[model samples]
Target: MIRRFRLAAVLIATTAVALPGCDRPPEEDTAARPPAPTQNADQPLELTTDSGAPLESRRGEWRDALRALLAAPDADTLATADRRWRDLYDAFNRHYLSLAAQACAGDRQAPLQRLDAWPLYPAYVDALPAWPDSGIVNDPALELSAASLRRQQGATADGEVALGFQPIRLLIAGAKGAPRQAKDLRAEGDEPAAALRERRRTYLKLAADQLQADLNALDRDDGLSLTSLRCALETLDDRLAALQTHRQATAPEEGLYIPSVSVEILEETQPKAALTQLSADANRDARAALESGYPGFQTALDQAVEEDSWAPLGEWLHAHGD
Candidate 1:
């Protein structure tokens, strides 16, 4: 029973392995071995007891199993060592959902404790790598991989956090590189058609990561602390503004001009594409608000250009004046 319970505990900890796009190293990979099959063939994804008992057979058996294993003295210290980690994992999901609520255009504010609690969140999130026996029945990684596979009907989900921006990337790259024929522009510049789409995809992914960092900081709720949120908004505004300006500058030269397309792309692309629906909405709103701030920023930038008052803007951007 102790050995079996230990197995069960391993299974529970393995659930975190299900997070998509997070590839564990070979030695640390969860699912390093075959997992024991659960009782129900129809519900392969269902949690199971260490003894291969179906977790759903009893009232809240899954949680009960977790509680019991956590309380056990002799079960295995390895299980106990991850106690706080698991608790924090559960907390992160809840908090992540809650923070999603705060994502809106103008007044995004997650509760203060959530933000304050964020720095501690990564330790718990990152610790999933350390859990033992990932390929076991209790392995979360196997379930996640299975789930992701199931989700796309055997197609791998790229862990995309926003609309695939390969199109935009391709378009931009073609424009940046030596001028191509109109036919080539449409053919090769189209994200889906471009051979270099992967590179653009990479850039979009990096941008998404940057946006996520901003979201994480905003959600880091140290008592509804607006400092980071404000900074995030400001950063987003600057990026959007720069993007807008770049689009403006390049539009005439590209011969493929569409301000609306640029606007749409800027509006739709965001950091939290793979999160829960609520969190995604929150992020959308936050992004919108950030975008809304752009008008003022654009005006400021425009005035700087119009008056040739580069000194103030330059000084503001640089720590020192020439």
Candidate 2:
């Protein structure tokens, strides 16, 4: 019953207030039907605010804020800004729905707690190979509180054992099949299904060996709990196993053809050159705003504010010092 898109918006409560017919009291409002469709149902739904303001319709004036942040002069500042913007966008785009799920499941401080718990998750997501599209399989933030609780309870060994299996989840999610219908594509070249089966086996074996090695070394020294690292590694192996089983069972006679998932990965990974510019601009604007009320930097600052550019600024200051 939780609304995915509605909960995902930044400052959703403000927009919620602006929504027409939202004032009917919680009981009645919860029963109210959604607003009438402005566009054809055949097309992707055009996102809008509660007041019927268009969101995904046109790029809007807010995009310029992103542009300004990316246009900043300092390379370091820009890099910092880029990371910040990237994290903000990633969090907003990737986990919004997932977060809603958690909140609905009854974690009140779910979002903030996540931010505190797994600081490395966003970076991990950015670095992950984008096969089958981008997403965190089990967002570290979601597990942060529970994981921390285990640590606090002195379940370090047990926790590591569980953590070792986490990567398998990613492997499964990244599989070419699943909710996505990539397996429907036909494999090309003269290689028969038998050959592909062998190849798949080889790939799975190699992946498993690497994963085992990874798991065995969990928590040797990396300050990371042996449990957490192993969870990720084991998860990867289990997913590989599942993928192999699925492929062997359902693989086409022509072999399992996924129209080059690497391309999708690469596309997802394309870096934003504008981030550096945006970051520098944001800082320059923020400083200028402080000195003279932000006329010079207002546009850029607004972008930073809109897209949550403060992340990169903080990172930049941390790396650069003072």
Candidate 3:
């Protein structure tokens, strides 16, 4: 049976504002962002399981899956590879990525973590209902290069995403409600359409390559300690609390990508099983770290674990009947 951590009583709160020209909005205030977590630099940790398989191993697996997907010869092959890549991506996000982010907080690698999890808007990468001619796919003025893509990674207003996984998803899966076929991406028998098709394929490869590079950077280090774990939990708690606040003020479609991704990860598993497993893993690691010498982390860890800081997210998902 799937289990959940008991929902926390006090949720993290944040203010949300609507962005012009888009239905969804991004978080506005950064003043309440948590302070950089403290880590014991002298004692570097190697996060792994009993079998000694490092957390970054999953990143390598994901990179392999991505390469397979890009090299797919036909629609059928692409579809199969796509599903496999997505499953690995979801698993990595739910388990390893966040932990790595916490472990590397305030380190030089912190920027890489943010780039990997950057907010993505579907419209920025491909066409959407509101903006049919939107995204880099349709815009001929924008060059299809890594440098060009990097420059377009952020949003000028709210609810707009120019880069990241969502863009990659849009490029691979086609536009929302309108999936692309192998023929659609093939450059043949046309002027504008042919050029567009070629551009589409180019964008997909570049994005995937960029994503793999970031993942490789992150995989280089797997050192985490009790302090890092505590930081991870607190960050999660803050995110859940912010999600709770945002849910009250807007519709599900209008919420932030972080919450949406969090819900999607939970949904990928059986109801609450993913979160239950996540908490279990955190607690297990926390115990191991505590035994090694971090004494003061117990109070915070107990509060975070006991409250099941992610309960509010589950509640929000259920409320929307998602």
Q: What ranking of all candidate models by lDDT puts the best one first?
A: 3, 1, 2
Q: Over the stretch 1-322, how does candidate 1's per-residue lDDT look in tens digits?
A: 1110122343223322111111221223333322222322122111111212221232133234334432442334324323322332333333332333233212442222212110011111111122322111122332223233223221221111112121222222222333222232222455434633233233323332332343455343333212223333233333333344444433322222223333343334321211122124334443333224322323433444555443323223222211
C-alpha TM-score for every candidate:
0.21, 0.19, 0.64
Whole-model lDDT values for every prediction? 0.28, 0.25, 0.48
Which stretches of model 1 miss by more than 4 angstroms?
1-224, 249-260, 265-322
The reply for model 3, stretches above 4 Å from the true place, is 1-42, 49-73, 97-119, 155-159, 225-227, 238-262, 266-322
Best by lDDT: 3
Q: Please provide, for model 2 over 1-322, each residue's C-alpha lDDT reduced to its tens digit, 9 standing for 90 to 100.
A: 2111111223222221100111112222322322222332222111111212222221222234223432432344334433433333332222222222222222222221222121011112211232222222222232223333223211221111111112222121223333211121113336553343233223222322332333223212222221222122222222222233332222111122122222222123211222232234333432332223212233433454566433332222223111
lDDT for position 222 in model 1: 36
**Model 3 whole-model lDDT (C-alpha atoms):** 0.48
Query: Once model 3 is optimally superposed onto the true structure by TM-score, how far is the C-alpha of residue 185 displaced, in angstroms?
Result: 2.3
Flag regions of model 2 displaced more than 4 Å.
1-191, 222-314, 317-319
Count of steric clashes across candidates, in order: 24, 26, 2
lDDT of 3 by residue, 51-133 (tens): 22333565566566556655654687567645655665565445542444443443433324333332334555666555566
Give the TM-score comparing model 3 with the true structure, all chains together: 0.64
Models, CA RMSD each: 25.2, 23.6, 10.8
